[model samples]
Target: MSPSWEDESAAVIAQGLRRRGFLTAAGLAATAALVAGRPERAHAAVSGSRAMPYPFTLGIASGDPLSTAVVLWTRLAPSPFEVDGGMATDSFPVQWVVAEDASMATVVRRGTALAHAEYAHSVHVDVGGLRPDREYWYQFRCGPHLSGVGRTRTAPAPGAHLDHLDLVVASCQSLGAGWYHAWKDAASEPADLVYFAGDYIYEYATDATSVRWPYTPSLPADFTRQTDTLGRFRQQYGLYKSDPDLQEAHRVSPWMVTWDDHEVFNDYDAEDPSLYQLRANAYRAFWEHMPLRSPQRPSGYTARMYRQLDYGDLARFHVIDARQYKTGQLPGSTVGDTAERRDPSRQILGTAQEAWLLDSLGSGATTWDVMANTVLFSRLDSDDTAGERFSTGQWDAYQAAQQRVIDTVAAKDAGGFVVLTGDIHRNYHLNVLKDFEDPDSAVVGVEFAGTSISSGRDGGETDSGLEVRTRANPHLVSADLRRGYLRCRISHDVWTTQVRAIDRISTLDYRAWTSHTLVTEPRRPGLQVS
Candidate 1:
């Protein structure tokens, strides 16, 4: 008899895995059982004693924190490099517990979640009914196997008075570029929350000259190619998450994450309908790997990520999605001052998002309004000559959209407006002006653009063209080419930002230091560099 369609599809997948040198005898058996759709085999895989390998190799994480709820994440991946994470085609029950202490003696919340094979055996438990502004320790348990413990906390209650809030902003970590020493350092810092602006995983092929090579069990064949399919993207995520240092950062604090271009493609936009399938695959993989809630899950190629997070009356976080709704860049140039660049119709954030942002800012709900943006929010002049030049990928490309935001903030008299940005792989402090053409214009707010975690390899304190670039743009206060993150402290009266820089990233053991410290006050916009 001819093979059924499902059998053929399974055969093709198995052959691809064999070609990639990832399919073992046990993996082949698992794939065949999944294709056969035998409930008996699926049931035995989870029920029989010692029938399945130990899962939960990817570690545990918590994200999307609320005053009374937090999402806990874990995956059943004994052999994570495999397409299905080396699990039987079945759903397994995973028990989770939240405690008030590290020992877990004082349990607060306990529940069970199903880890489904369709979603790579990943589990997301949205634990609620917890106390506000309290710390919790959580862990997961599979059949005879226990996952690591993770620490998390809830946000301050609404209208609650907060003396201060410490946050760490980080982004752009390329696994092949360098070591994750910066993440290790970030894990050690005292922070209330961690905001990962973008670039959680790069969709690039493996680097032949990777500093950390000969990975345990070797990298899958898919790593040799750029990620465009769901399986490949999943493997890429598995590879990055295998890093102990990055895992430590996630285990230490609850992360608020968004995506940038590298997560799918370099400088990709939603204007092209033909790439919808690719986007769908990437988006699905992203959702499966992240500790996101049901609402953030993707439907086909679209997902709504723009939302607001408030920390009492102290501050409000407006996390924006810049890449998904962005239009394609102007043809033939990436940096310029062309007429079309200034067109009002050219939008970076779509009309709906723009309106949402404006309305939220106009509400004036908190002492500080912070935009957790993914790109440089201030105009950056790259050309040293008399002619002005700007990166079209940044806010400079959509002057009208940027102007609308500025106008809203100014008109609404927003108490303390600040933009925390990442991307560009460098640190920058800019005085956001009402007019970029005139340096003497009123400074409506300030922008603290952070450097990468480990994207551009080892960098120095200053780049070759720093002096010229600084001279061209007077709004620029300082620029440092390094690998580190921004440590920010927000209070009712003052907001302090420390430009943290690491000594090196090519090597594992490196030192970190503060390159600059800047402060801004409520109702006052410009930075006072200390």
Candidate 2:
């Protein structure tokens, strides 16, 4: 029989009663089962009789989808900002349910996964044996408390023909900078997927000017300190996940996440052995919070995050990890086009990942090959007429590697290659050229670098430097310094991108609108403003 929402509600009510000392743990479990009107297997699996803390405060998320399966995630954190999330140093069985409808009346799968204390009592259930190209609602139950239901959709079969893919690309959401109105708006849409480009959570404490959580329960006495260790990183994730808007967005759609520098340390790379241990801790905490399977988890300091996910024959997304393997920025200004900056051997994506990306791009049979890349892949020449330079942190620092990737796309005749980027906290629409320094170079693809969710606070509409920046680089289209995300509608014939910007991020006012619309035809590689 299918699960019932009425029963879930009853379970919640029973949980409240248990918490209020009106019922024993076993009595509460039995009462919830009775209220749910479900069999023993349908209700949550009860273990200890001790009163348990509310564990779903961090909310639930689902992601890393496949045709047959997707990962459903939740961390047991009754006291989120506490050192250990208020979870005992033990394991608990978390019962998960997948249904076809939001009411959860039509159940498809139900299973129990052990929430491991070693990994912050988080549960990542790799539920499989499901139909493809459809939506599913899922929820978890522990003791008498039930989590909010999350909606997730699996990708179509590898060779299956499809019409389009609706997606939102977002990045750089610093919790303390502003509100999450952007995420709230995005969650209201019916997008098939969400691409978290990077900076899922900032590592540092809030500054004097930044707004912070008004009610940070369980926060450490010194919660303002920067995150560096495993415990601290886990607390950071917990703090960010506590945001309702972000949790709702994750609850609504499956996300493909790839982290940038802030997820570890700012602008860090694999070149330093000293940072490896810190990276390991950060990576572990990230995996613990995210709805990722075992394959993406860290084995020591190394985690294989760069991988490909094909959305049927319509599109194939190659999610890249730029921060983990790139070399340190060369000694130059943020936008200095030095000879060292253009060094051919300067590494980004390391060696193996580059090869893997090339292979994935070359082998893709889809109409569009999208790179869910963090950091800009295209060049951004400074508007300064005195001297032209580029951001050393981006692909511009290693122009040789950038060109190789673009050349591979061109050489393979890859159709409609698009790069979706985040970081830099701005909106940019640019033509990915064969040689960014040469105006006459062929346009291999187009790039849409989205603005942050709430990173830079409230920015004005007009930037005086926009004109000079675009004039210096002919391929540059539109640039907005505000905070928001990119909404892309992809099809076999055309790709449409909308720059969805938030008018203000400091307040609860959710005044957001599409600032610019751009479109690119299948065979035509350049972008045209709509």
Candidate 3:
């Protein structure tokens, strides 16, 4: 039987209760038996092919880590088109192996999973019960094919003390606009983890015009570039995964991911199942291409990609799914007044996801709470005097829900909160406000919203509308329209985020420098700490 949120949550609670003897060990064992293990066919042994050859024909990738476990990913490409291209109709058995060394001499874990017809035969293996903060090398295997070598690291154990943690955060990568220079820089940065916050590939396919001017349309509206079909989604992943630079980044270190609008569509709602299927298909394609866990399989029209990963006691990573389970308001739904923005009825995170976030915050014991979520959670305005409202699609649109998250964390974790936001396609630093319109209200979190990887290229002068926006929102301390990522480093007491801006975009020589900086202190509420 498929698992429901409440059922899974109850199971987590039950495990905790069992540990405390509220429930018997025998009872817990029985429960485990009911919901344990992969399918029998997946575990059936592979006798031959000990000396597997030509690994990494496609590319390497990794994701979804915990203290002890992390998922490793790769696809076998006899031909990129045959495997991940979505053009082929056959299925292949993809094998995976994780080792302690770059060379496969010291093998630790090995398994075989089917690269199915629907998912373009990708492999996502959830490797569990391993050590924390340790590095591992992994590779994929097919009948006679091999994938490139990839590396991954598990998160630091919860409550363990450490001196430092480095993470690179980024989002909104449109394929047609430019090169992955931001990705190149991010890959080269000396960071322990790179959290791809969302929009790895746009759902739309562009044409020569989008390639030329506003030029990219994901294809023309009349021509229809990307397909809504499962096969098309698979092909989209293929196109994205085929990028050498992106693959190189995946090969370097572990990644934590969450999707935004473009992953599925501009605005999506979970309430409607059919449309939701498209999102699910997109999610499945993402999971297959990514290094997420295996059980992350899609159910009906949703995938459980949101979860927490702790890096010792330094930080707790909360990856959220802001797209799937949402009540998509109109495209540019920014409205006036907190009343419209704060309506409890208006949900950016559907009921279930909201509960999950609150519960994770309540139970987590990390020093820093870094939310790897999509969309700007801060109150931003493109116009101030123009008096245009906020987009109902952003976190600001669901004021009640965002406030609940802040209040929950504040009441529980007095250690301060740090949110890493994306999807606006522009860089911004905001002093997070529990009630944005009302400054007298609590200052709950500090946000570092990164610019896109070539998404918005209004590379002219500062937008006049933004000046009005700055004039209106006191919480917004800074904003920049560029394409780049944020390099954030955390020590025991201080947290620093350096927004590195690409000097020029869509070019290989685009230089980057620390465009801005923000510091956060323990127990302090917002971004004001210097």
Q: How do all models score by TM-score?
A: 0.89, 0.91, 0.82
Residue range 1-530, candidate 3, lDDT tens digits: 54432333234333331111101233223223321231110111123443432324336777776778887776644333222342256766776777787655577887777766666656677777678888887766565334455678877777787678888888888766766677768777536788888888788765553432341212214224664766567656655554545766777778888777677876766676678668767777777677776556777577887877787777777788887777757445567655656668878777887888888874556677777778888777656564647777787677788778877867886465888888888877888766665777777778888888776562422577667777878888777787788988888788888887886655445686777688877567667423
Query: Against the unseen true structure, what C-alpha lDDT does each candidate score?
Result: 0.79, 0.81, 0.67
Q: What does candidate 1's lDDT look like per residue over 1-530, in tens digits?
A: 54432333234333331111112454334334322221111111222256566576566789988889999998888777667777889899998889897656678898889999888888989999998888998877777455666789898898787788889999999888877878878888747899998999989887566665533335567778899989888888887776667777888799888888888898886889988998998888888888889888899999988888888888889999999998787664365787777889988889999889999984647899999899998888888787877787898888888888988888888888899888889888888888777889998889988999987668887866777788888888888888999999898889999888888877656888888899988887788899
Clash list (residue pairs), candidate 1: none
TM-score of model 1 vs. true structure: 0.89
Q: How many steric overlaps are in each model, in order?
A: 0, 4, 22
Model 2, runs deviating above 4 Å = 1-6, 9-50, 213-218
> Better model by TM-score, 1 or 2?
2
Candidate 1 regions exceeding 4 Å error are 1-49, 214-217, 362-364
Candidate 3 lDDT trough over 10 residues, lowest sum: 37-46
Best-to-worst ranking by lDDT = 2, 1, 3
